[model samples]
Target chain A: MGSLEYRCLKATGVYNVLSEALVEIRDVNFAYGHRPILKGMNLTFPKNKVIAIMGGSGCGKTTLLRLIGGSIKPTSGYVKIGGQIIHELDRAGLYAMRRKMGMLFQFGALFTDMSVYDNVAFQMREHTNLPEEIIHDLVMMKLHAVGLRGTHDLLPAELSGGMARRVALARTVALDPMLILYDEPFAGLDPISLTVVGNLIKRLNDALGATSIVVTHDVQESLKIVDYLYFVADGVIITEGTPDEIKASNKPFVQQFINGEMDGPVPFHYPGGDYQQDLKLKSIERVKNNKRKVTERYFGLDRRQKKK
Target chain B: MMAALTKNFVGLGRRVMNSLWRIGIGARFLSLILLNSGISFSRFHLTVKELFFSGVMSLIIILVAGMFVGMVLGLQGYETLKRYGSESALGSLVALSLVRELGPVLAALLFASRAGSAMTAEIGLMKATEQISAMEMMAINPIARVVAPRFWAGVFAVPLLAAMFSVMGVFGGYLVGVVLIGVDEGSFWSQMQSNVDFQHDVLNGVFKSCVFGVVVTAIALFEGYDAPPTAEGVSGATTRTVVESSLAILILDFILTALMI
Candidate 1:
């Protein structure tokens, strides 16, 4: 373990050397108005490991990150991070707790007005009393670590999508956060950039010795880097295991998800009436329409012909 | 018939409840801004940059619009006063109109359309792009860093812009009345000085503009921060900012004017 991890673990004083889970979600439920998103979710993220939460869109993966980050409160139950309940903290307490956390939004979410250097330096400047010289070196080191030191002067708009994501990654790790959350970090990336980002997440997690939770749909890349995998569907964890176990499992959902099948327990189409019945009705309507058209053509009573 | 009536009543109640809920949220947001406004002042540079965008950039429109309004008032006032053999009172008419009513109202309307809309669009876009969320996750209160500076900047900018508008208006009136129409320059100056009271006219107008500044900025910021995180949502919020600010300014002007009178 790194010295920073040791110090953090020591400071928290809640976890033993063995089985040190940094975050624990206990029967947490969340909803937007009447629409329930997450229901009775129980998960543990261990320290110094990379865990990937895999799910289709709108499966409450991002919502899970928000819950862990203390941005939103769960409706019932709680999320405990480093021994403190996230939603129970007051504003000041929450902000203090947030200082130990970092989130990489799906689209980088860099301040478009600020350059890459300023973006990386933002957390340090805001949270610490460090002078400009130290901040400059720290920002540059972060940029270099992301392999984008040359693009430090560029605005987010000036950088490519991949470079922008890299800068955002650098910014996320700038404070050496104890827990890092990534929301679809591999989305909308070329092959090379995807691999680069995937490797960077692993390397950064190891170097910082921080617990990282990656919420992603990129199954292949996630399987390659993640220590454990949790598959979420319809707001609950359906299954979870190591990559090899997931690959070898006979569960229909797991097999379908892994193989990218067109039809499975997750259904290819939205819920609707009987497909054949609907198609037959449409065919009958089309036949009637065609007969009407033929009659109109025979009588030279077509709307187009009349208009002309 | 009974069901239809019940449904209509329910719809009306829901609309009223929603409006009240929004107002409550806006009040809470304003308090958050006040609570977090320390950084806006302490850092100061952030506020200054916002002021440049919301204030300095608005100068040309405020000045030019003021001039045109003043000139129109000059011609119209002279034409009306000439019928009553009081054309020499044109200066007093123009000055009182500009300083008392036209300056604050017109400047605020323009600011609502120009600076206020821009403020909403910027914040809404930031929210849509998740910059605000990123800031929150970074342990930075976005109200302090983003909203407060712009809020305070708009609050400071509107009154200054109004004053500039009034001053330019006076100059435009002078040019039209004294130079173009050949009204006696001494009578014009004397009449304006005697008729335009410092406290009643100038101070009240400044106070009105200050009230307008608060109203416009608050509405714009609230709409932006409350906007849904989507492109269409941001665009809608921007439109609402202008519409709501303009309506609020006009209504507030009526109340303030009635109270002052």
Candidate 2:
């Protein structure tokens, strides 16, 4: 079969797989005090699909995650999870709604005082009557899924960044939430951890049949893991498609972002000089510098050296 | 200079009014947060520990401070009354002073400065780091889950501590009067017991501490809830919670004393 037919078949196969509109962000606009962050934002994640939202820093990606997760109410719009209006719910209603969703914070956000087992079992103990023995089994199963069962008794501070995120992921899935929200899941991770988390995200999505919405800055890794994608910049979503389509888009913002370039339609907001002056100064420096430094300055090649 | 001072006075008055308004708003928010926080066993345990630490653990310091305050009151009262040849009344004066004034007010002020600021900072950090948000996403109510235990704990713990302070202060006066100054212990104790009535003083002191406890915990939790979403915001919240709660405790002490007396 041709690629188009294969793609069509794959897309249809996912429709009704988990079979619900698990999360819907409709005409949402949010503000931090008087500063507007997200305006007229609209998005949807159907059940059983992994959707990645990629953007630069301060692009309102994480804010969108907070809005959908019901951590903050939008100033002028509404978010619905499982077709229920989240913002309108009373305290009890809101708490009940929140129980259906899980979140993996960018910083892992584990309770520093609790052990990994306690952290994962927190929601179960809070909202359910499950015996401690059963809770332990479920927590271990979730930990084993993330390959961190060996560290189940460790405190969050004892774990490295990667391991913390794994523990956080395990905790996020502890309740077997119908949906999961991942905020900057792969940012700052080493290549190995990135791949590990990426694969694990996919694995969890498949095994638990949980829909996921990932807010990230790692384009290549996100594209690999997500089934659908949205690209955001300057507090608004500019374009959205499958990973192949996003990569193939000729839009200047996407192009400049994906290619990691300086001279493009997206102008640099240099601290003390105009774009032309900055570009000229940078170009001369690039020519005189070593190829390694040049590549590092433009393409993130120095990351390897810094890691070593 | 006159014009500037007048303007400044008016500004200060308005600021005080605004502060009171915000405190009211904070109390409302605290209740809403508590209402939203669903009941859970672990959260209840955490709250109990927090209350015990904030309230009970500080009893020794409160008692020591109260004793010193009582001795100072007796010494000063004796000096003042000596001129009028009314030194014999020192027993009644010291008892009334401690049970009616020094005990609850000082203890509450101390609690606000110490525990109030710490609670505010803890909650502020939780907000800045999105841990509070994480709790919400996990179907946990941040206010009820976190603040209510501390609130009720303060409500219950502060009065008990204040009672301890009052008892210590009276004994402190007794130490100076009967043991140090050679006043007859029996006469001093009997006179104090007669002069200090429950309706007039002891119950009033407890009432004041209960109010003070509510105010301190409410102010700290309010500052925490209103903390800005950054590290600096947490620091600012801690400072404001401490300063404002202390001031509020003193001012409310005056009001409660006026109403009760």
* Winning candidate number (DockQ): 1
Write one digit per residue (lDDT tens) for candidate 1, span A1-308: 43245346646774356557799899999999999999999987889999999988889999999999998999998999999999999989999999999999999999999999999999999999999999999999999999999998899999988999999999999999999999999999999999999999999999999999999989999989998888999999998877777778899998888889989998999899998798798789899889879979788687666779
> What does chain B score (TM) in every candidate?
0.97, 0.86
Against the true structure, candidate 2 reaches a TM-score of 0.82
| First chain of candidate 1, TM-score | 0.87
Cα-based lDDT at residue A163, candidate 2: 97
- Tens-place lDDT per residue, model 1, B108-161, is 999999999999999999999999999999889999999999999999999999
Which CAPRI tier for candidate 2? medium
Residue-level lDDT tens digits of model 2 in B86-185? 7777788888887788888888888887788878988887788778888978877777777777777777777887878877887788788667876667
List each candidate's DockQ score.
0.84, 0.62
Model 1 CAPRI quality: high
**Model 2: lDDT of residue B206:** 87
